[model samples]
Target: MKNKGSRRRPNKAAAPRKGEAASDGAGGDRLSKLPDDILLNILERVDTLDALRTCILSKRMLKLPTMLSRFDIDVGNLARHHDAASYGYTLNHVIQYNNAVAGVAEKILSARNLEIPIRKLRLRFYVGRDGCLSISKAFACTMATQRVDNAEFVLLTEKSCLKCTHDNLLYYAQQFNNCLGDYPAAFAGLTHLWLRNMRFGELDIPNVLSTCKRLVSLRLSNCDAGVRSVLHIEHAQLVELCIEEGKFEAVQLNGLPKLQHVNFVGWCCPDPLTFRSVPQLRKLRLEQIGISSTKNLQLSQFLANVPWISDLHLDFRSEKIWVLPESPKLLAPVLGKLQIVNLDNLPEGCDMAWTMFILEAAPSLRELCITVWDDWCKIVTDKEFRRKNGYCEKANVEWQPSDFDLKHKNLVKLTIHGFQPDVIFVRYVRRILEVAVNMGDISLHDRKVCERCMDLDPEIKVCPSRYPRTTEEKDMLKVEITKELGMASHAVIHFRS
Candidate 1:
């Protein structure tokens, strides 16, 4: 943004004229030396209008922008440009902002005459005033003229912005809906899609998937449908799916054949994560997830159907901790292929036992990383936060792992975080090293403290708090685990802050 005292220069970019010469015309020029395809690919990375602006440079580059496989129509941040941000939202400022939106839509419509298919398209526009519905219909008309493989359409309403009121945003969406007809007819070519903010208002997710059978990957993040609609997903060509920060009542995932990756983050409500016959699912991540159903939302059930999941990461925040119990059906596949596992937010005094239970099940595990939050440590030092979150900071109980001698043969590397020097914790580590004959390397790290945690509650103490784990405490645990486990003299062990 430029101040009035330092006015920005006017646009020097002109429309493409015939027989224009390059600014510097040697064959050794950096841009001209590249092949025609490479030059076109570089232009595709920019916005369509910005790409056209380059046509003023040379005549040979004029025809290359029309071959762009990707198109982006962004208007959210355009209001912050020099012309629009010089003053407050007065009458003149609002006119300039609306003109910027029309300019972006016009550039996208120009691609219709090129005839080449758009492999990927992303359009982000604001919906606030009278022209929003017309803009939406013009966008659909442009879609009807061209074929697209991957497309994302985001209509940012007033609910998502602070400058406009909710009534104005809802009116714009309602107006757009009254005129939007047969939009599903254009989904025949869309395979990959991502929608934000606009949910069932303009598009029903279930109906869209049912109509578009060729969809491979779908992501719905921060959408109203997650809270308002019931999503019924069943596709044969779908491979990857992600639903982040949604509150859906019933999200049914059924009969996805080629599905390999699934990421569901921040399930605010207690909804069941249904899994119906996904055999090829491999990689899975559930972060900041909590379910209301204690029985149906079990990890064992999700793993029983999918046998080939190799890499797994789970970060849970819930009323109860999930125990890794022995299951013949799940253990058979996990023992054969499961290689890497990362577990975070593991509660102290109760999670060590679960670690052994997991090791017994996955005999082929190559790497294991666990993040433990010392419950007693936090209470004794940082009591206010624990109390604020309804956690019992003062409740006293003794806990230890169940007896097991199962050989975790393939485990060669291990990293344990939030290491404490208590007697019970040291014994748990000693027993694992004794049974795990192929132990190669182990690293124990102190707890990690972030700025947010320290800023939120000043009463809580940071690492090396009132009761810090001294060097003597760390040394005692290392020495005992190594000596009792009968580990080789050359095996490596490290302790770090």
Candidate 2:
């Protein structure tokens, strides 16, 4: 690395001369003294184009870094070439871009032979409809022969999807199918693999899962494919697996003994799980799945086996509700460990007792969200349902919440939707606050008169003037008042003291 520019004058403390002028030719002196290793490191950090330009700077920096163990060849950089269409350059520039990339790739691949024991190799290519199939075949050929420790394949472009009549998109999808034959050997050492928006054809997912023994994490999202074999795992090395929005059937979980987290979304399977397949499973999720029905779902038995589950989100709208047992004792043991529960459109008559079960089982619960049948859960007035027996008033709550709070002291937050809090609801809130001294947050939706400003605030004297402090104005603004309270009730949020 030779110094190209003039250096500054020497400091007064060190390199001062006796008779030579302060502006002596010592300007270039300090830069020449820098070691070769530091300059080489600086040059290696530049982009590949700029790194190649360094060859013009000095003969010594012309050769690429020998110690470089990792290299990424990106075709996106070559795609930036500006060419005028008036000069008869429609696909000509694309051809030039492809040729330039191929030339660079050849040089890099040849260099890899000399840089033996290359740890990581990354190739990212973007191809339009005009990209030659020969080029894709050559790229796949290189990957099969190269050593790739970690790989990411992203095929995302309108050209790749091929909106026009050409077979470009189909060709792109078939490339992955062709690459699968070499996947075992090419990606044997791979620790992480991510494939996104890929149109895959004839890739054996089960074979890939089995062959990639060193794989610890795998993610495939928005892959376009037809019904492939249900993903079966014969390996236990996988720690995390995520499959979302693709074509696949029942995923066999038998082989993943060490698997901790598994996410399967939009996976249309008649049965999502088989017995004892995932014993070590910690988190299981099924969202927006197309299950024909929820009849005879052995839900409790399944929950009993998955004791480590701390969060469960299941959207079972495809199945009928009210089929399961409705007592706390039946569900509390399994649900006791649950920290978050989200249920939508629960069958009628499922709300009142289901809430009690939650309060019992998940005492450590921080948040509870439930959709209830408002028309059915009537508010039994205070005059009714008095404890007739020797049992204390706390023993019986006709939808009273104080009883719920006494046991679930840690219950800090509640979210209720579609439940109109009549007199019963108000008492429930009062009791819930009693137990939750820290008084967590609450959210209510689709309520009619939960806001105090609508009706209760007039009685409380908070907003007396504009909000119809008078009785007649309050009657005229009854609807607004009702809307406000309903919103507040839906949230069940604790109000200011």
Candidate 3:
């Protein structure tokens, strides 16, 4: 039966609801007509709690919905329909929410009777006074007997929740004391794990990573693990590690034989990170990271320690690094093994020294990617999210090709997205064209208007290939670039909007 005031969904058949026998003559819906995997895909999109509610009272719902593998629920949407900011709200609604959580746990426990494994499960919900103690127990019972490869449990604190009340937040903070030890013991087979906004006791880090013997990737975001002291992380099987949105005084990364990638974002280490015995690391990505080097450590020293790095992405666009001025010679360290380099971020606007540093350090580099957004992200706070969707503007710089490598003969492909014609950007473009001898058609694209920014700034111009859009700004810049870049008559320059 359809509920009142609900918008009409597509006329698709659904799986049989609880208490209905598969052999019953009344259940000939199209949902039961499809294969089990397709039905599970459709169910994965709905709130996981809805499935639990429908099967709550049925004695035959012991094995859960057939072939249902992935489940996700967003607790933040609990009162999205109506403004819960009302003072008239009472304890009855809170109790009902708690009961709903307990009910879902009971339903998940029914997965014990299944033969197939749950591949992925994600829960982005609030952790009120009781936290996820009940749900974790349910997972311990069911997941211990089955396989769940990927899991993300984000416990939203009151500060992160806009609609939650102070009273409710107090309850959640007091109850969210569960640690990695509270998890299922079957985690030995898990490959990927992400925990956000959770407290980590002194030993939780090692215990969690070691428990998942096969865990290949791990992420910790906005986590509390006594960051004031040095935190050491070591694992034999871990290949990728990420720490973001938090500040740590110091970190020691050691003894990971197979580790390949390390990503750090919005992280500040007062003492430079100490890398112990990671010999197999091949890739490193640092974004908006702040490092106060007391030991006068050159960034190149860090690169030299990882001799096999093939790809490097250093995004310094978000946070400011002030010590860059004191160390203009930081880039000429040792990057001879690097093949690809992404230096698209502009620290304190653009600088010619950084570009010269990477080019001189990495002589074997083949490809370069740069962008110039229209400075819109800086002007409009409402559209700030556009920056994350690949909308960026190149910083204007006065680059002197003579002071550095005059001929970058190795670069074969050059892509310049969002070609803005400011004096600084024009200078940077002309400099690159002059140096890259083996370069092909220089791909010049205009600014991109994101889905949200499109209505406000309709030009929406950006091309991967060397072709100009029909916008007047792009057409005019195309001709100007042809004249200014000074490319030979035989050289082809693709102008794109």
Candidate 4:
């Protein structure tokens, strides 16, 4: 018999029998019991480093990494301190992190099973010479040995655009150009490439495009040849192109047979883009802060060459309206196939009836989405800053509908963000109801909240917001809207707070 104070010794029989697994609290190793395909699918969705760490938990999972078809290796995912100094690491730390990334990529790519083809592979690392070379060689070896379907490389500079000088950008571009020369095979197999904060030479961009034979998508942020320089892109297999904060005066799509989607942002040129020989183009998005000097765009002339666009998005950045409301007859040929339109960031306290041009132009339009908000945080509030930067003051856009009797049967849904209970908003909705007779749904949403704007000084003048709240308020608003329109509308009205 045991003493009253004595505790029982651990029982050997209660433990797992020899050659059997121990219980994992919930049960015996449930995740390891799952089939290989299901486990691999779960692992593929996470970062490659995390997947590798999970594999270390069990012997069964150790071999799964080698069988994975998709690998996403991003050095940014590495655990680091949250302090301000660690936001962008020092040179030593950056090199260390990149080396670790290169080592892991080499290990995995070298040990991959040759029987399985790589469906997708992505590597994002800092632009370090030795680490880049090692990673490029590993990628080249895998591309030569295995059947790689999609491969992407996202190269980041040591410094961000704000911290980089003109000389720094040129140096970064030269470094990347040297890397391309050293690893032609790796680049030739690349399908997607995203480059940032580099100002290449006049011929450098075209050369890079020509070398990447299989590139399907390319994004250049804060990259350009020079101010007011024209960029002519000609690629055979490219499908998607995005340019952000570039200094190019105009981007000419000279020859891209398979291109379909384009997005241009923060362009200052009068006519920023032109399309040629892009038969498959279907979607376009343009966002800019219009100044007093910027020329207003006319869609009829702007999209004359590319008449196959089905989705168009225009963002005015809440400064000035830069898109002219044109006659529907002039816009019909270009907007014939348009099915969706998103007019984002229109200034508040302005006439919105000018937007009816889209309804009259696109006979095939099925959805129209508009967001009206004047975010104080993004707009310049200081008088001196506004004058120095050439920012135009807020003003109403002048336009009158060419035909008020226009009828649209295809528009089914209308969505308005920043909906206010005011006469202007009510009148705009009534006009849409008059035009779109067969509309089925109208969704009105409150303005998007901006944290920085909330912290701003209370002295800045802005329109008072009166968005409806509570079920009773919404019901009353619906009744008032219907009463103002003086019609028994058939559309379902929803108020999303």
Task: List the candidates' TM-scores in order.
Answer: 0.67, 0.50, 0.68, 0.93
Per-residue lDDT of model 2, residues 51-106, tens digit only: 55555555555454443445554555545434433233345554566556656755
lDDT, residue 118, candidate 1: 75
Q: After TM-score superposition, what is the CA distance of residue 484 in candidate 1 from its true location, in Å?
A: 4.4
Q: Candidate 1 at 22: error in angstroms?
A: 16
Candidate 1 displacement at residue 326 in angstroms? 5.8
Please give, for residues 230-281, the per-residue lDDT of candidate 4 as tens digits: 8999999999999999999889999999999999998868898999999999
lDDT per residue (tens digit) for residues 155-229 in model 3: 555444344344543344335544344554535555666655554557766777777777888887665465464
Best by lDDT: 4
Cα RMSD for candidates in order: 10.0, 15.3, 10.1, 3.3
Clashes per model (N, Cα, C within 3 A): 0, 15, 13, 0
Shift in Å, residue 271, candidate 3: 4.8
Candidate 1 lDDT over 309-375, as tens digits, reads 7878776542235333554344555445778888776655453655565676676788888776633
Q: Identify the candidate with maximal TM-score.
A: 4
TM-score of model 3 vs. true structure: 0.68
Worst 10 residues of 3 by lDDT: 319-328
State each model's CA lDDT, in order.
0.60, 0.50, 0.57, 0.88
